[model samples]
Target: MKGRFWPKARLGDVTCVMGTNGVGKTSLLRAISGTHPRSSGDVTFDGKPLGQMNAHKMAQMGVGYVPQGRDIFPLLTVRENLQTGFSCLPKSEHFIPDEIYQLFPVLKEMQTRRGGDLSGGQQQQLAIARALITKPKLLLLDEPTEGIQPNIIQHIGEVIRLLRDRGDMAIVLVEQYFDFAFDLADRIVVLRRGEVIENAAKQDIAREQLLSIVSV
Candidate 1:
């Protein structure tokens, strides 16, 4: 299926994309990230064609993707895993920023710990911190709340809100957790079968209507 995210103007600071499982939510992110080759259609970021670019190029272009399962290098130390984001940066920008630690203090404490040693919540935080290391303009988060503890989920939500409030980047969150998304999104995009079914500002559509659209 073909799809595009050409918002009339700029996308909101936080845009939540929702659909049931197997509805191509992850596929959309993969396409945008250039991680999966598309059969057709061009993807452009800030007027640059992304269809021909590889994942590394996408990252270098300021697109940070935190895929669903928090893919951290198990054998690598927390610090080492975060540094992997440096692959897209210059030598001078190799060091991790103190801001990343501020956003996730647990990561600062676990800097020397192996990625495999951290709890699921900590691992998720590490994954996000790793992506932030690139200082992306577009951040794509997939099911960030999945399998996470409530307290950790709350903390993650706070971090996301803080990021959005910074007014620097656009966040596209793909989530099934309705309450979580509703609370944070400035707009909502609902999809079904690889196609966008509804795209509207969160206030323009009623919650019941949005729920029904996704259920269809």
Candidate 2:
């Protein structure tokens, strides 16, 4: 996770981390989300020093993570799966928001369906919806477009855009899909062998140049 870092992210911005496989993209997100321990360096959230807290603490501190695999509980109904996010909230705020259903209407259609029975795209949406239920100030999405069909990917992109434009949270998206990431990113950080090779505002870099850099 050691690299030349960017300035503190502002709410309403999307910071995309791009790299080839085995270059620690997922590892970076895991460390930031506290799912995996960082070997070195400090992590600060909301201008406060967060020194080696666990995942639950991170969640409570308004950090929501949707891991690479869209890890929804297989046996749980879709409604129950979303309810899992209730763990980090006060009991009074336990109800799922209507906006969650608006974001992914299929979830509402299949509320009683088992998570395992949903399509991959459906599950990805559920995973994101679950994280949104926590109402995070910082959302970390890792490889969200992987294995997703085009239409669903577009839908997810729109959802991310809406979330970003809402200006309530900062999104850190680790993506291998170049076009999708490039379109959404306000700033881009490129990594090679766990070190940052490029970090710049998206306007400062050309699409072709970014593709060439990551292709290597």
Q: Candidate 2 residues 1-216, lDDT tens each?
A: 556775566799999999899998898889989999988878889888899999999999999999999999999999999999999999999999999999999999999999999999999999999999999999999999889899999999999999999999999999999999999999999999999888999999999999999999
What's the TM-score of each model vs. the native? Answer: 0.95, 0.98
Q: Which sections of candidate 1 miss by over 4 Å?
A: 1-12
Best by TM-score: 2
Task: Give per-residue CA lDDT, model 1, range 118-137, as digits (tens).
Answer: 99999999999999999998
TM-score of 2: 0.98
RMSD of each: 1.7, 0.8
- Candidate 1, 148: how far from true, in Å? 0.3
Off by over 4 Å in 2: none
How many residue pairs clash per model? 0, 0
TM-score of candidate 1 to 2 decimals: 0.95
